[model samples]
Target chain A: MNTQAVKVIYKYEMLRAWNTILQSFASPVISTILYFVVFGSAIGSRIESVEGISYGAFIVPGLIMLALLTQSVSNASFGIYFPRFTGTMYETLSAPISFIEIVLGYVGAAATKSFIIGLIILVTAGFFVELKIAHPIWMLSFLILTCISFSLLGFIIGLWAESFEQLQLIPLLVITPLVFLGGSFYTIDMLPPAWQTVSLFNPVVYLVSGFRWSFYEVSDVSVELSLLMVLLFSVICLSIVWWMFKTGYRLKR
Target chain B: MSSIISVSNLSKVYDGGFRALNDISLDIKSGEILALLGPNGAGKTTLISVICGIVNASAGSVTVDGYDIVKDYRITRSMIGLVPQELTLSMFVSVWDTICFSRGLFGKKPNPLYLEQLLKDLSLWDKKDNDILTLSGGMKRRVLIAKALSHEPSILFLDEPTAGVDVELRKDMWVLVEKLRQTGVTIILTTHYIEEAEEIADRVGVINEGELIVVDDKEALKHKLGKRQMMIELEQTIESIPESLWTWSLELSGNGSRLTYTYDSYSEHTGIAELLRAVDKSGLLLKDVNTSQSSLEDIFIGLVKVNNEGSA
Candidate 1:
């Protein structure tokens, strides 16, 4: 398994996050606080509640998921893209480590980073609204799954990206919009029935719905369906990553 | 000595139909220093990259210590350390961190004692804490070497290691290579600097147009194609070659004041005496005579030229 190889890569990646303390750790904390202020105080003062949960409390899971989605993608993508861009990836490629080890190192580190950010956002959420959990285990399960799967997606994006512009393309053009329209800030039931049907197409809906259900036991979709969707998405991302390594796409020539 | 690395019928056709390596077959001995000399854009780097597992060969196979490069990659790759031609280091990572990562990357147990000494040997000990971005180009090159050696592999590939290095540092690198050779580490290097090969290589391989045209012991390669030039200084300039000396095929240079006769130095009969006699008899009074030995560069150029002409 080349565990030491994985460890060193993991530690180095973790160290990089620690080194960029403001960007890695502080950004999510500040964003969580701001999202609370703007969406919680500004908007929540009017809406009061959604689906019987306080507006401030209702958006907490969505906020964490939003940060999780973006951070996981960006962290894993940049973690890999930096090495490829700087040509340092040659060392990793030539090393005795296998593709699995490389993924474990890069993706694992990125997931860990997002996991920490998710935790930070959760803690920040605690200060603003009373936090409650119907299923802490499921909440954690959903969070961990999202981290791993999105990090895998991010790893793919990193490998697939050719330039810095390409790196930003998927996150901005694809993920951000998906997260926004995925019912992170509002319930899809509140939308026109047509828009609600359209929202089902966005994969982020399942992630947000599943995560929100874990917290408040209120979800747009069934818990089992949400879990299956997350698992299904992870499997798809996993298969893509496996194919990338096997075919030597972007990582080898 | 057993071959530490064996590449058989290796061919690489890059994505856009560029042939990087064409049927390269070679065996690197256990502890000998081999220098691959080629012009720019030649397959030297590509070949090294393939054996080191950075690039996948389109056809054929390679084995390091009897393990296939692709099938049993871990075993084969663990046996190799590659310092690529480019400055492939992280700008933000400290020198110490870089080596530590590489050491672990190759699955070597962390040995601070060994790493510390390695940094000291490369004169990078003081800069261990400094980011690679802060170091000079030469220091970065040294860091690359240190990173390659971090795992203590039996085979090391230094792809143009001394490129852009100063003369003094180049000498130091040569000394370091010799010292490494003493430790029984087999070294393969690719360089445009023929003298670097001449100075240290036990064997030299010349690659041209994605083909390994020749690989032989240093002395043997020199003995086979190493031409010697005899410059005969005439007392006065002449308008044309004397018909009597035309049979010798001497080159008239230095405004006809000198004549150059190229001959195989290793041949029992170099024909040097005959050419000189012919020159004297042709009314060219020799003021002085000087002989120059052709360097490996000349042989390399000759090989490439011949290969190019063959392709053309």
Candidate 2:
């Protein structure tokens, strides 16, 4: 429909997210640094090189995905949740803006935050270990795609949440565990063959592997498979979000 | 004026088995103020929400300026402005930013001059740069009004626009409302304060228990349903009412110094003469006579009570 309206919404929503970027910077950056300090310095000593890359550098991409995923989900979820909580959701729903416009605006903002966090973690990891970029464009593409996919997922979570506690549940309980068990600190190859097959089923594995492939040119999974998985997740999440808007689900209720 | 909003057989039944709005229907004319008056849980909010397209109707059709609410939602929503009752503003956003953002939400380009004028009119110009959280409750309420009017919709719905405001701000809001009305903006407001409707509404609609019980011109409804009371100060104290004045339906005060006679104003016969004759026949000299008329509040209470009793 109105592309200009969506752009305007995206611009302002991005600005709103930027306005609060500093508040999140302290915690997320500190967490990333701790990951680097503990995993790169302490854990890397005992764990030798895996897949010909240093343990410190091997975990960088996974850590970045972790940052991207959690920040993307939190920022987008809170972006929609606070508005609904404060009653500004009424203003948005009643606006001439379409559902795509609203989602794009919010997801764009969330993705931006995730990108910023991802960048911060990337820079932080560089201080501890040497980083390589095998395909800079693919890295950026996967970064954006993963951010958007999880942001859409977060947007849906925000709509379904009735209170602040419910809003915090997903990022704390669901995404954190998924990221931890998604081959962030250890490769799936380190697991038993059966566990490796099971880990292949974890969606975060594809995201982390795709990000790792972008950096070191080596991944537990194929880059093409990881890209396809990210694309598929993005499409499915986008469709569900679109359906929620069309049905006016919890957003209107 | 032609009708600007038409709602037919609108109803909303929640999954909890509560009928939030029952078969409600009403037509709002352009360039007029229609006050939806009701107590809490009377479906006033639900009616406004549905018409504004914020809530879906279970079974009904609503057309705003000939655009269906559901089928042509974008156009219909663009034509309507709703000032919700909740104090739900972005606390960190500046006042000017909030209004401009709201205007942008309607796909309107930024008009700094119009925004300046709107802020000035609402006495929010001085606080344009101030974050919304820094403003007092009254000023935040003003910002909410500013945001609602930012889009410049033709029809405005204010849900309890002045529920908990100081007298000065309420007066300012009423003045602003009058100015908006002067610009041919049709306003439909829901309020628990009957005096507000009595003061500004061209027509008043009363809803009770999810159903619209009455809709009439403010003064006309007052005249049609209003009751009158005549209090007479008796010259001498009486232990009880006199049988001679029983036909007058008079009641004696506890102190026996006053007599009150209640009568319907719309009745063809007021029976004041017959009551006076009987009072004289009873040898009770009236020391003083004072008359009082029912207000919109009285009429609303009476209508709601009658409707509830009838339904029960």
Top candidate by lDDT: 1
Pick the DockQ winner: 1
- How big is the positional error of residue B21 in model 1, measured in Å on the Cα after superposition? 1.3
DockQ of each: 0.86, 0.60
Mark the regions of model 1 whose C-alpha exceeds 4 Å error after superposition. Answer: B240-247, B274-284
Tens digits of per-residue lDDT, candidate 2, B203-289, equal 999999999999999989988888899998988999989888888778889499899999987789999888888888889988998
Q: Report the C-alpha lDDT of model 1 over B1-312, residue by residue, as the tens digit.
A: 899999999999999999999999999999999999999988999999999888889999999988899999999888889988989889998999999999999998899999999999999999999999999999999999999999998899999999999998899899989999999999999998999999999999999888999999999999998988898898999989988888878888898798888888887888877887777677778899999998899999989999999999
